[model samples]
Target: TSERILGGLSEQGAPVPQGTAAVISDPVKGNVSEADVSGAAGPLPKAPEPAQIEVLTNPSAGQAAATPVQNISTGIVSAVSGATSERLSSAAAEQGAQLTLEVAAVIGDPVRADVTEAQPVGPDSGNGQSPFSLAFLVNLSGLIGGAAIFFLVGGAAERLEARSLRTSRTGLWTVRLLLGLAYALLIAGAELWVAFGLLGVEHEASTAQVYLFLALATTAAASVTMLLAVAFGPAGIGISAVLNVILGLVSSGGLAPLEALPPFYQAYADWLPLRYVIDGLRSLLFYDGSLDAARLEGGWRDSLWFLGGRSEAARLEDAVWMVGAYLVGAATLGYLISLVRDLFARRERPKTGKVAKAAG
Candidate 1:
């Protein structure tokens, strides 16, 4: 007996077998063909009865006059069979023989999705804060005022001592204080010109208010430097640099947030005039120079004058009054020190004369 074989190899190189020979018979067209078969290797086996064999249909071979439904099924089946045959042929060449049946899904409408993208927030978003502006307006102003006063007053102190004209008098101190105030005003004007006129930093305060704020800040810084210089002479410049420039800026929270600083620096920031100046600058730039004392909170860290907490209003008020107090207090203390030194010198001179007369 002969056996039918699908013209292909399995994945594992095994031949595909059909139990008995079959014919592809298109019933409508009456087109019939026998499938390929292989003879038995040795003795002939008994053949199956005709009733056991089944006829497969080749829907693709039907006549053109077939119904539309039949034609569609024919096309689909023909494509699937052609694809399957190619796969089988390749498999047979590579390995042995194979046969498979697969059911395909029906075609449907296409799928789509709507996607959204994200954007980054920038300075224009109202949360903007510039480190450069903070440093320039606060830190730089303090340092510049300290240095300028040191050079101006420190040099004058040295010259006065050299000419034996270092006298403690109210008129002299009044003139010196006036000079410092005038110089501070000039520095404030220059800073404003650079920040607003040149660099174009936006601000909520009027130019006059900003000018007054800057002038007061500079005067406070200069007064401290002047006090050191008048009391300690030229060596006070070094003292001023250490206190106002290095220690002051580090403690002022201008270079970094107060929360990020050490406990000591954070505490120290509350005492420094620079911190008040920085807070005031922030208020002027962002908060429209708001002076509501009700705006108090802890993190501002500008001044410790109030017990409960700090605020933009507290900062602005401190910038004007507290810093102004420092200007007056330091200058007065420097003057008193001068007066004490003069008194000591007068007493020593009288004692020296009495001792010289006794020796003669």
Candidate 2:
């Protein structure tokens, strides 16, 4: 009996069996080929029987055999999917956080930047000052002083007339004019002292400029008072006091700008002399002196043609002209009223003499 070796090497890469011989079988001729091993030390061993292998086609048995492998593959796929899902969730959270931060940054930027322009000086300028200040008191004092002058002049004229002093009409006119001028000078001087020396009103203009404006304003006020006195006699002092002190101060734009006033008050401000006076004073006190050439040119043209457009400086000049015009117009009106009153007095005198004769 002889032993046969199978094809291929052992685990250590040697031939199959240490002492066995290899056999090759031919299917076509039913013959066996053997390799001799006569030089071996021992007799040959008996050959072993062929292995019996069984094949099964049953579905249950096949599935039972493959169950572990399927389970292992499924576990690997689940682990990969879980890891991918966790990574995706982490990425999504980071993106959401970044987006929230960006949105917050955009929303908070404007508050930090403080985007707003500065307002100009006016009632709505938000300067945080109350309406009643030292400046207001000083202005009110000037009005009271003007009213006192009106009363004093009226009383002096009444006293002169009561004494039967035969003064010519021309002489009386001259005296009234001189008295008005003197009162104007006194008021102007008093206002300068109170505003600058005592109250210390902060102004941008020089002392000379402020004094000039005060003089013009006081002169205008005096002229207005004299006109009323001549036209309505001593009773006109009360009218002058109301016009110059109460109505004038109310519409003067001293407490607020004209634009900020109510519609009714705004309309009244246009006709009030104190409005222009205050406007000119404010321009000289608060406004910068550097003029806009184009604006000045346009304003000059508008003034020449009696048009509406004018800047702050032009408006101040217009105020000076208005004061001058008031002086001229008031003088003419007062002279006419006085002439009419004199003519009426002459006519009444002749009638009174005839009535007395008839009665006797």
> Which candidate number maximizes lDDT?
1
Cα lDDT tens digits, model 1, 137-166, are 544555556556556654676689799674
For model 1, name the residue pairs that clash: 8-97, 8-98, 9-96, 9-97, 9-98, 10-97, 10-98
Candidate 2 achieves a global lDDT of 0.47
TM-score of 1: 0.53
What value of lDDT does candidate 1 attain over all alpha carbons?
0.52
Q: How many angstroms is residue 306 displaced in model 1 relative to the true structure, after the best TM-score fit?
A: 10
lDDT per model vs. reference: 0.52, 0.47
Candidate 2's residue-wise lDDT over 307-329, tens digit each?
Answer: 44455446556656655556667
